[model samples]
Target chain A: MADEAEIFSQLKQAVMEGDEDVAVAAAQAAVAAGVDPQRAIIEGLAAGMAEMGRLYEREECYVPELLVSSEALYAGLGVLRPLVIASGKAEKKGVAVIGVVQGDIHDIGKNLVKMMLEVNGIEVHDLGRDVDMERFITATQETQADLLCLSALMTTTMIAIKDYMPAFKTQLPGVKIMVGGAPLNQQLADEWGADGYGENAVEAARVAVRLLETK
Target chain B: MHRDHSVKGKWVKCDQMTSQERWEALVNRRPTDRVPCLQFMLGHTAVVNGRPIAKIYDDGAESLACQRNAMALYGHDGLIMHGWANAGGAEFGGEIEFPYRKYTGAPLMKKNPVQSEEDAWDLRVPDDILSVGTMPIALEFSRLQYEAGLTVTLQVGSPLTWAGSVYGEERLMIWMLKKPELVHHVLRVITDFIRRKADYWIDRFGAERLMAFDLGIETNKLYSPKQFETFGFPYLREIHDHLTERGTAIILSHICGEQNKNLPLWARLSYGKRGMVSVGKEVAISKAREMFPDCVIMGNVDPVTVQEGTPEQVRMLCRACIEEGKDHPGGFALMTGCEVPPQAPPVNVDQMVKACRELGRY
Candidate 1:
């Protein structure tokens, strides 16, 4: 079995290379080698992603690099995802169902948010665009997830968060919902009846974890 | 930027004119005397300059200031703001996580928020466009701008864009293939809402004060011209006609795309009849002029030219836009096909405007 140090390095290498296949293979190997899946995910992939994000923010990397690296992270998750489940290891500290709100199609930002969370070892169920009220509720029920994260990019569509919460509790009272997006924030989140708000991708995961810890 | 912009020449007061009167002059290929240059007056740009993004949307006064700033900056003969960036389809009713990015400190609605067709059906246009959320606050801000005697421009929903907001771009694209009826339904809702909201603002600001597009195409076409005509045009025409009836002479139809399949149809629409096609570079504005001689056109200069190119390059480009457009004062408006990149060096923008003013024989 390899030490956490070795596996982390390999996982970082795969992600930096933007090789999704290699990232996934390495992540699987990491888990198989007795490195904790969650640690490998959070520390290994997420760290590399953070660097990528920083580079992106700095203009060192553009869209293609960010996208390719995200894909690599996706591949890493794919490999490690099943093991956490098969072993009933509870790999995800908590699950989050996230999506862009209705009346909005913009997703690059949402995808980034999702990937960032996933790399942090949150079980992210992406409810792709224009998700209905029921599906949002149903996904929560199905996953018995810790958090429901909603994203609305459009000023027009963001208002739907108003309806979602009422429906969410009326349907399932215990589920916690966090809504975030470009046009929204902690204040708007509270106004919209969301339990909490995350200002950005990194914050979303941190918030998601905190939400679950309380749960 | 040269520390002082002494706009020493002539500054006209457009306040006395009613919305309808202003609309008529600009829409019918009449010379409004000045181009409409509404740069980042409100919405995202407002958020950029004003208080934090969260507060700008929340505060009525701040939103107004943003709008006024945009108007002041460009002081175009017209103003255009057809819509705003949302968190995504999911927040409204789709699936997305539109975070207020801390790094860039901007907001966005990502694409592919909707996960399925059923989700699309389950959605409706929320009334909050005017009443709830920051939108109503924005409308109130526009009202304040009008009350304060500012020339007005606003945005409305384009069917395709509205559909994209609800269904997610990917799903909407698939809907174009699988369930176009659903796509049309979504479009109808957004179009109707936009029209209704336009009417609301028209009641306040009066219809047709300033010209702006519905921003029919964002980065370019994901739809063919035929599809746009078949699906998008009818709605656009209806809105334009409705606005026209209410005294809106020009409903600028905006597009920034590679394929112009829908452009000719967009050109023919009554609102866009003498109206400007805010075309970005990939499409030939000159060819568009030949195809639709009466239609006004704006933009095609690459941001590179403005951001990095010399004043000479900007001058040359603006000259081309004017020369190719052949209708600057009357039938043409000069502008970036998309919003001027916010970070664009102000000098290039100044150059573009200067060239626009100088190139005209009028």
Candidate 2:
């Protein structure tokens, strides 16, 4: 049987190459070898995703690569996450509620951010695309989420973020708000009373972690 | 570029050319009085006219009227057209929702036409392209432009962007890696559909009078240059070659978002008699000028700044863009990097024209 380090390297390579079968096999080997599932996730699966995030930032890889790597990461996670829970070592960094705002169905950016957040060990409640303001408020309250990340790709739909801001402040007083998308900038996020803003998904996860640390 | 003339015993750059005259001069490669401000706006026009945003997408006559009124109000030069970036889904058999409700901007694709591999294989260009969804509205809008002697506009896809609408963007993107052949098949169908649509438009309105444009969102932020070369460039080249060969006089490509990496590829496409390229803020106007030195460089102004920023800020950005782009040999027009946000302050929108008038004079 391969050693733990070799198995971990295999898992990371599988994710980087977007090979789900290899990732699954490596994860099962890690499981059979009595390697901690959580360690395998953190050192193998999440590490691979984090590398993809870096590659994405450097433009060495693009969204398609990130999407594929995400599938591999999830495939590995599908094997290991339940084991981690059964081992009673599933500690989340924080909870996050994420969605594309109402009137905008474009969720690619939101989805990316969600995956990044999940890789960072945040329990993300993805509300999907064209999410209503009420849904966001309810999700945040119910999840008692540490952070709320909103995305809007269109100029028109971005208005929903601004319109929903005051209500979020009133209803979910302590929950930190984050906004991102192609149309948004740091200035708009500041103006809209968001606690933080990310230019891309990797940066978004970084900001979410920072915000959660403060909380 | 406008020069100072003796007005009331003072050297002042007064109104030197009408909008029509300025547009003509720019297109024909003649000297213009000053920097022309072209708007890449859509839903904002309806908002300014106190109409639902849906009017701008669903009702072509109303879209034209709203746009014209907004143009007159702002005193900007051109680019009055119908259609959004995500345009082909409805034409290809997907359901679309026009922006009638609050917070809705442009039309939204309620469902994609292709959901699975089988659907992808079955996708084809409609036999009657004109009778399909939103084609009638687009035709009516073009008819109005033709009647008014304005530039008739048509949204021809970059094929890849339309494919994003035909199949869902994420699914299409994944297919680009896992099932590239399938992706190419869909792109092929989209290109054929775009060609048929372009032919119809050219047949109806003389190619010389139409501005064939593609709103491309294949930003480097989304796709690698290689991905674009494979999926985007070939289809774009085919369409552009076809348009130029068929005597189409102009093509305005809104190379939307951060597509600096794709510039080399974009510069490779044939742009007919004249080309106009509009870029988002992530791309510098100077870079756009360098890439397409013979094509008109339209923008780099941040639309968010135009929406959320102060009038002074908008003017400053406009001034910066005009200064950078105003001297391109091909031509230049001050415009928002992307679609002007629907609820941008009126004064902020006016700031662009005001900047052109005050600082952009030659």
Candidate 3:
């Protein structure tokens, strides 16, 4: 009998490889074999992605690697999300809304944050890219998400976050906002008056989840 | 002299205002009545504007006429002269895909072409400026920009990124770590190639009409800042040095990524102290004012905003840009963070230039 750790590893590998078929089977197999789905996702798939993040931060990988990891994690979630939601066993970490900001189409980073969230057991409502401030505000309200994440690849679009957050707080007071991307930083984040900022997708996920705890 | 807002002004005529006089005023932190212009137009944007990629790559009178027709019809300032945006990497054999632009009918992107270290080795820097497929087309276009008496800058990839396109990003990082000499060797060749190309354009356009060099890629901070001291900074310095020897006046270094951490090490690109540094939007020009307080700072328009936004939004951006960035004599130029998006609405761009004109001088 394969231990939970062993089955989890297989699931992690499947997710990282972007093999949705293998990921589903591996995840389903783990559950049927008496393994905890939450542990499998967090310690198994999420851990693998977390390691990939560490590697990426250290420059062990590049954009393609980051992209592949995101794709893989999502592939695994395509299976795990349903099983956990159906059994009422899905994570109660917190609900979060995330997407890339308007005028920018790059979403690899956005997708990676989603994977990290799902693996950490947070229910996520993704609005996709080219989203304006209104969409962010509306999504936060409709989903009643505890956290909102915005990503921008260009500095010009990144400033739009400054505009969005103020408007968001006007209606949804104290709703924390986090922003990240190639052209943004902690200073710009501060200047823009964001609640938080991250340099990469993994850091974004970690900070977002951390914010959720305080909320 | 106060000039009215008219696109009909002889901007390209002999009696027209001297570029140095106008450009100097904008960069010197002096508020001009008319907005001085600077941009980073990617080949992708031109293609995406509904012009066919084939025509953009076609080095012929008809193709040039087509591209000119597209840009001129849009009332753009004029295309910058240079090599294909992907010329360096594609010629060196990087994996790339062409995203079809809805408006321009041109293929818009190419990426991830190189997959390994051997792939990097296989990259051969061209001996001639027009060595790549669309390179001649690029040259012709650049010549046309000069012919129209517009400011034309030739944008090229940085050594590391040009290498990344050939060796794959993974190998690029590893090579920097493990085979420093080998990678630097390849970088030198590419640098030499770029220098040769820059000289070729200068020979054709005359240094006065020539704008600057665009090395838009992640450098040391994105990797190791020391690598910048070794590879990115020095290699770039080589280009600037070469241009300086020829008495060229402008050099814009564009690196877009999580690269703010490495700004202090880029002393060679210092502004006001010696020369000008056009930091991309990735590095906040506002923050850079404090960081490299003496350096000339240009840039940070969002390509996507210009591409997909309403004209009003673009005008708002233009205003915010001038307001946010610090200025001095020769300290700033209005440009995008990286390459301008090909699909950017023509009218939005018009609004941006209009916004600049409203703020700048004669």
Best by TM-score: 2
Q: Tens digit of lDDT per residue, candidate 2, span A1-215?
A: 88989988999999999999999999999989999999899999899999999999998999999999989999999999999888888989999999999988999999999999999999999999899999999999999998999999988788899999999999999999999998888978998899999999999999999999998
The DockQ-derived docking category for candidate 1 is: incorrect
Compared with the true structure, model 3 gives a TM-score of 0.60
User: Pairs clashing in candidate 2?
Assistant: B1-B33, B2-B33
Which is the better candidate, 2 or 3, if ranked by lDDT? 2
Error of 2 at B30 (Å): 1.2
Candidate 2 residue B109 C-alpha distance from true site, Å: 1.2
Q: Model 2: how far is A19 from its true place, Å?
A: 0.9
Chain B TM-score (each prediction, in order): 0.76, 0.96, 0.73
Question: Could you give the interface RMSD of candidate 2 in angstroms?
Answer: 0.9
**What would you estimate as the lDDT of candidate 1?**
0.62
DockQ of 2: 0.83
Candidates' C-alpha lDDT: 0.62, 0.91, 0.63
TM-score of each: 0.54, 0.96, 0.60
lDDT of 2 by residue, B151-193 (tens): 9998998789999999999999899999999999999999999
